[model samples]
Target: MTAGAGGRPGAAGRFASAVFGIAVLVFVLAPLLWLALRAFAGSWTYPHLLPSQWSLRWWSQVWDTPGLTSSIRLSLIITPIVTVLAMIVCLPAAYAIARYRFPGRQLVLMTIFATNAFPRFGLFITMASLFYSLNLMDRMAGVVIVQLIGTIVFMTWIPAAAFAAIPPSLEEAARDAGAGALRTFFTVTLPLAAPSILVAVILSFLAAFDEAQGTFLVGSPDIVTMPVQMYSLIGNYPDQVAAVFSIMLSIPSVLLLSLVRRRVLGGTIAQGFTIR
Candidate 1:
């Protein structure tokens, strides 16, 4: 049979797929390109396809901005704390959901998924008054707590899936070798699930670091995160400075993902499914 008549997609199909992929790439990258341009552009009036001049003034402004430094520091402190706390709270719960056939298991899972599915703004609005009453408003702890609601839901589901992918037989083997449940988990199950756990940690950090609405609603003025600072700057300052701040805000997450890309991509969630 000819190549066109073979089971493979025809040239037209390949062409269509390529065109679609290129279109998607452009759609996603266009805004980022514009932001980058605006961040450095000195002047670009209407009808100009590109900037008439370019300068480092906005980049300098980003460093000079007083709130920017504080916001970055707060994000740095909060993101890691949120990631660790979410992992600590979610790990056992995830393991239980993965390993045990408990009452209300489906209900628990559904509740988590539902919480994640809900509109964050609505939740923030509803909780704002409650937070103030509790004296949690404008506190870093409150922002962390608010961010945790979504992160925990996400962190639980991912690790649960990862743990489920691990075979019980491995735990059995570790036990047969005289390892207790906790020891076996730390020794075998945890090592095997580390990659996925790392993914959860990374995602949790990003969620907390980039959290804007909740931070703005509950922690603004007292505890400004990078995203909240970006929003505030965009509202009050020039767009170019805001773009520079946007770039600054994105750098950490990009660096983090780049750092962990090797481990995440090298190890599979189902790595523990195999005997050896």
Candidate 2:
């Protein structure tokens, strides 16, 4: 805590901070580093710091495995469908809650909040029985619905806050210039809130992409997604193959998150989470 000539903190503080930051970074990344090593290693035995042999054999084997490819395909197909459907269903509700003051408005917001507040697995278990009665079990529609459940809070609440944050004057100005309600919304209000909504979309996309438990409960035997495949891989295959698949599962998340990293850091998404 030594001070500089101008009374600013000295080099000791900077050095300590730098060291702490580096240590935390290493701690966070160490698991991924181990996974990468495992994915490429031909043989990594006890007491070995590095592999005796390194090859792309696990990558090849992961692709060659039965059901793995289709699991990936199902994830690809289902994740986007869930994302789009969520946007379609939740955005209008978000807008209505943000702009209007109806009788049940507060109750609706509370209901949205309650969905995430409860034990989600319990809710999913309850839904599984209902899905069976409705004949939705083992269907793509059921999987999509299961994925959609977790996404509703993010899609609705975040965008609602984003919409609420926009100035009334912006929409009024658009309306004053001969724009209709729909035109003003499209031209001014929506565009102003687009960044936050985009963040919600990304979050919803990732939620569906990573969903496994409910998907397995409803769609197993007939629909096996990549995350669900991880269950079988860990029990039936070598560690390296599972590591390769784990890395594959993380790629889309890394890429999509990079797009909103700046806004996320700047609090665009954080502001939405505090919605009334």
- Per-candidate count of clashing residue pairs (backbone under 3 Å): 0, 0
Which lDDT values do the candidates have, in the order given? 0.83, 0.91
lDDT of candidate 2 over 147-259, digit per residue (tens): 99999999999999989988888888889999999999898988888998999999999999999999989998889999999998996899999999999999999998999
TM-score of 2: 0.93
Q: TM per model?
A: 0.89, 0.93
lDDT of 2 at 177: 90
- Candidate 2 lDDT score relative to the true structure: 0.91
RMSD of each: 4.3, 2.5
Report clash pairs, candidate 2.
none
Supply the global lDDT for candidate 1.
0.83
Best by TM-score: 2
